[model samples]
Target: MDYRVAPAVRIAGRCRVPGDKSISHRAVMLAALAQGESRFDGFLAGADTLATAAAFRAMGVAIDGPQDGSVRVQGVGLHGLQPPAGALDMGNAGTGMRLLAGLLAGQRFGVTLTGDESLSRRPMARVIGPLRQMGADLAAEEGDTPPLVLRPVAQLRGIDYALPMASAQVKSCLLLAGLYAQGQTCVTEPAPTRDHTERMLAAFGWPVTRQRGRVCITGGRGSLQATQFSIPGDISSAAFPLVAAVIAAQGEVLIEGVGVNPTRTGILDILRAMGADITLLNPRDAGAEPVADIRVRASRLRGIAVPPELVPLAIDEFPAIAVAAACAQGQTLITGAAELRVKESDRIAAIASGLGMLGITVETLPDGLRIEGGQFRGGTVDSHGDHRIAMAFSLAALRAPEPVRIRDCVNVGTSFPGYTVLMRGLGLEIEEA
Candidate 1:
């Protein structure tokens, strides 16, 4: 699919984005492991999360209706899952594949996981090494990439491992595996990453201990009780419109029920540093996760050197942030983001190339990008089949001099399914072709 995004005079409206994608994936996984039916409200109905659901169903867990932000999973208990008939196809979800590796490591039967070209090329070695260290028979492709094969293990032993880098997926993978391990499993991160796994574990009645950057969990101690909960709006998905509203010529937008978890609020902090006019309205908690309404208005933005410490926090959001930087007043240097090179697409390269195509003075860096703030002239660009890249370029249309045509945007459904519709409703002129 391609999107021709024309310049917008104003973007105004109150919008609610889909439920948090990360949390939605974890919710389905955890629920599928529980002893009984687990119901979820405000669940993300994206293609990626649905892939997670489908994989679980193939394993004997009965999941119904991701319809209208609600899903019910008839869990098969910790040890009740039947071996799937064939390889679990995770499609384009790196999160589903990696985290499922942990969950399947301790299962009684072996399973193979494969994906599309984009996901197949993603490095799986990070999760592979850890799972192997924990005594699971696991192997990846020659380049440490995907088509991960896992052989059933008699038992998994818990280990205290420190992550070489800050990754929520790796941490969550190990933590999920810990549930079936013999002893206490601990993961000490170099920096704080998203705590969706820990938070959801605790919400499911599993005890999780966190001290500074280290998180520890004891396996085989308790059973996960199936429970009901509401998922907050995804702040990551909200980022495109948030940046669009920031760069728009007029009006304000209120994004309601957004998950404002501290570890995941790096984009908010980065935007504030760039002098974005943002406000948090009606702050509260949706279970352990924090929720708030985000109000952003048109503001003159000035680019600043984004802090390294905040890089991990806003890692998933850099594509949109780069769009904001392009519309800013000065130079924006983003460093400590080497992780961006390994996402669904090489985000740093994709963002730089796409922005350069749109007439932005962006210099690609080994770790990040050096973007000089300037007006964007609409032009043709490719999304590299990455959802974030596609959406980020759509936001560039808000400030573009002409219609910006973005290609390979069909993958946008992987994360934010109704993104173009939502943006169009906000008064942005986007047409699908």
Candidate 2:
């Protein structure tokens, strides 16, 4: 599948993107471990999130209706999950596979977790090393990549470990495993990452303590309690439309009910630094996360040196940031983002390649990219089967003189389903081909 996006004339409307993907994944996982039935409103029904729900179902948890962003999960308690019939396929979700590995480490039965090609290629050593240190009998296919095989461990001993880098997935994985370990497990990160896991853990009645950069949880201390939750709109998914509104020839766009957690607002911060006219309205709590309405208007963007400190917070949205960079007035320098190399694709290279095809001057660096602001010409770009790359290129069309054709876009549904329809509703000239 591919996307053909014509030049956008004006981007004006009020709309909402899908629910936060990270929160949706965690919601389903934690809900399945809680003691009773939990209802979730605004659950993302995308392929990646559904894969998490399916994995729980395979382990005998009953999950109903993700229809219209509503889902009911009947949790089987922390230790009540039944052994699956076979290897659990996580499809395209790296988050699901890593977190599930931790949750399943202390179980009595053996399990194997696998994924689609892209996910299978992602580095798992970050999560694997800590899990192994906790006494998990697990091995990856090539020492670092996925297809994780785990044998039942009679007991896991928790340890205070510090991450070499900041990673929400790795931290969350260890915390989940800490739930069953013999002692308290503490993790310290050099930089702060997303705290959805910590917040969700507390929401489920699990006691989690945080002091500065460290989060700690004691094993066998408490049980997860069922609770209702309402997920906020994904800022990652909202990035494309936000960039569209920023670079459009005319108009303003209001994106409602978006998650504005301080940790995940790097994209907004970076864009604002680049002179994007973005504002947050109606700030309030949506369950454990913060929600707000985003108002963005077309503005003259000026690129600047992106701070390395903000890299981890905006890691997933860099592709969209690249589009905004290309539409800016000067140059944008990105660094300290080596993590982008291991995502669903080599995002730095992928973004550079796609932008170059559109006549943008982009110089690829090992950790990041040096993008020069310039006009975009109509061209065809390959997404390398990465959903974010595909969507980012689609947004680039808003500033192009001609239509942009993005190939290998079949994977967009893994994160954001109904992308074309949603963008169209906001007046972007986009369609599936």
Candidate 3:
């Protein structure tokens, strides 16, 4: 599907974004392996998470409803995942395949994970190498693309593996495989990726621990307790509206109950660094995550050098941050993010090219992107089937001289459930074409 957004007045409203995609994926997967039913609310009903639920169901686990963003996962024990009758279609979810590769690698039964055209293009060697080191019988396409066939390991033994780069999916994939391995599984990284799996796993009553920089998982008879899980509001999804408020005309919008996990708040920090007027109010703790109301008012944003350390935290926000940079007063440099190349699209080039079509100056770098903040003339752009790119340009549309048309916006549903209605509620004119 295609989407078009026209220049509109400031977006103003109090809205609750969808559940966090990262946590929601883990909730369903972990719940599938638990001994009892895992009851969850605030589950993201996005297509990616739904793919996870379906894959589990195909493997003899039961995940029901979503009738109202509510889901119950009846988990089969550690060794209970049945062999899939056919290849597992993972859709555009890199999170699902990467993580599930580890989970299924150690299983006594064999399975294969496949996906859509786009997902079939992402590299999987990151998880493949590590799982192989830990005695997993896994093989992938020549370029690490999908068609990953994981057979029962000769011996799913534990091994200490250091990450070649920073990736939470790779780290979590190995950890999930550790569940069934003999001895201990250790994953040490030079830098920390999002710890949602670790945090959520601990909350689910699993004995996982971190010593120094290494997270060690001891494998044995494992069972998870039945628990109530509430997925936090997705910071990635909220970035669109948040940046819209930053650049939109005279608007003060409060996005309530946003998940403010430190690992996921890089965009918030980056915006504040650029001197954007954003306030985090009503701070409190719920669901083992810090939740707060995020208020943003149109501000005269100025570009600041985004530090490398913040890259991992705000990595997903880079596309939208590019939108903010396009409207800021100076040059913005984003570095230490070569990982963007492997997303649903080559985001580094995608952002640079698409935003350039809107008349924003973006200097493409090997591992990063540079955006000069200034006036933008509008035109159509390609989403490359990336949700963030499509949504980011919407904010640009609100500030442009012409409407911003986003092609291939069908993927937006994989993250945000109702893109059109949500933006329209904020008083912007967005329509599916």
Candidate 4:
């Protein structure tokens, strides 16, 4: 579907965004593998996380819906998963394929994992290589794209795997594969990615041991204890509202219960550097992952160069970050983000093309983007059916000279359902096109 967003005048209010998508996906997968009933509080009811839950249930796991915004997951343990009734479709969730590959690697029953065209195009070799090392029979096309057919290995033997890229999805997949490995399976990251999988594994009483720069997990655990988990608010989903508040003339917004994992808060750090009045309040440890209320206010933003070290923490936020950069005073150049090319859309080209259409100065590079902040002449832009790109332009529309028309906002439902309603509630003039 298409959405029409007008320039926002001002926004000054508090809103609680949805639960963390990363944690929500892990919660469903881990809970499905647990030995008893698993309870989740504050779980994201978004379409993506829901796809994860449904995918697990298709594998014969018992999962119940959002009865009061919480879900019940019945774990079947490491080796207890039943063969799925049919092909498992993950939709647009890259996390689903990455993490589920680990669990399926050691299963006694072979299964096939597939996704939508967007997901099918994403390179799965990052995950496939590691799992293959652990002796899982996973088959894909020549390009390492999905339609992954995983054959039963009875048991996956543990091995140390090093990632070429700093990807949490790859690490989590290996760690999940480690769950069924014969011995200690270790995955080391060159840079820290989101540690939701590690944190949640520890919460489940799994033998998750971490050392300097590396995490090792042993397979063949007797059984994982079932427990209640409170899913924190998603910082990624909260990003739109956060940026909206910062860009609007006089808006101050407080977002409650967002996951504040330092590895994933690059947006907050980048915004702060650009002179945003962002703060973390009520910070506390939830399931070993930090959760807090985010407070943000409008500010005169000045652009700054984004370092590569912070890339892993804020990878998902770059689309929104591009918006923030566009509203800043100077030039913003992002490098070493070649990873963006393989997202839901070719984000570098998509963002550059979209913003350029709005009369913003955008220089597209092979890896990253260079944007010079200036007046945005309101215009229509295509989202390329990417959720983050859609939301990014929506936030930018607040400052656009005229209404910004974004095509295919239906993808927004994948990660942030009710986005139109949410932004409107924040006083944005958004209409369905």
* Residue 331 CA displacement from its true place in model 1, Å: 0.9
Per-residue lDDT of 139 in model 2: 89
TM-score of 1: 0.99
Per-residue lDDT, model 1, residue 228, is 90
Residues 1-433 of candidate 1 have per-residue lDDT tens digits of: 9999888889999999999999999999999888788998999888899999999889998888988898999877888888999999999999999999999999999999999999999998889899889999988889988898889889999999999988999999999999999999999998888999999999888999999999999999978989999999999999988998999999899999999999999999999999999999999999779999999999999989999999999999999999999999999999989889999999999999999998999998899999999989989999999999999998888888789999999999988988888999999999999
lDDT of candidate 2? Answer: 0.93
Error of 2 at 299 (Å): 0.7
RMSD of each: 0.9, 0.9, 1.2, 1.2
Q: What number of clashing residue pairs does each candidate have, in the order they appear?
A: 0, 0, 0, 4
Residue 285 miss distance in model 2 (angstroms): 0.9
What tens digits encode model 2's per-residue C-alpha lDDT throughout 108-128? 899999999999898999988
In candidate 4, what are the lDDT values of residues 1-433, reduced to their tens digit? 8888888789867787877888889988888888899998888777778888888778788888877568998788876778888889989988888888887888888899999988988898888887888899999977999999999876789998878888888899998888888999998888888998898888888978888769998888666778896888889989999999998888788998898988889999888988999999999977778889999998889877888888778889999989988989999888878888888999999999988998889898888999899877788889988999998998777888788898988888888877888888889899987
**Candidate 2: where is the Cα deviation over 4 Å?**
none
Q: What is the lDDT of every predicted structure here?
A: 0.93, 0.93, 0.87, 0.86
Compared with the true structure, model 4 gives a TM-score of 0.98
Give the candidate order by descending lDDT.
2, 1, 3, 4
Relative to the unseen true structure, what is the C-alpha lDDT of residue 132 in candidate 2, on a scale of 0 to 100? 93
